[model samples]
Target: KEPKEQGDAKEQGNDDNSTEEPVTAISEDNVKDQSIPSPTPPTPPPQ
Candidate 1:
């Protein structure tokens, strides 16, 4: 159940990144903090 939940959350984050830049930033930080291993689409370097 935990793994399934995490997988769904990760996919949700990936999808959210498209419609919400703020959410994408937060999601990226969460991903790093959680040490999520899923491959995410390349995010351009922050300026």
Candidate 2:
């Protein structure tokens, strides 16, 4: 039952993920542009 519930939740999350992706894309583009010279994406993920 627990496993089934988690599976359903993950499946449902995929539907909502599209809406969330644009926000992330905007942020990623902004960060990529600002830190083009530096590797902030990798650096921030670690910290």
Best by lDDT: 2
Off by over 4 Å in 2: 1-16, 37-47
Model 2 C-alpha lDDT per residue in residues 1-47, reported as the tens digit of each score? 99999999998899789869988999999988888757756778787
lDDT of 1 by residue, 1-47 (tens): 89999999999988787769877789889979666444333333332
TM-score, one value per model = 0.36, 0.36
Clashes of 1: 0
Q: Which ten residues in a row have the lowest lDDT in candidate 2?
A: 36-45
Give every collision pair in model 1. none
Q: Rate the local accuracy (lDDT) of all candidates.
A: 0.75, 0.86
Error of 1 at 45 (Å): 47
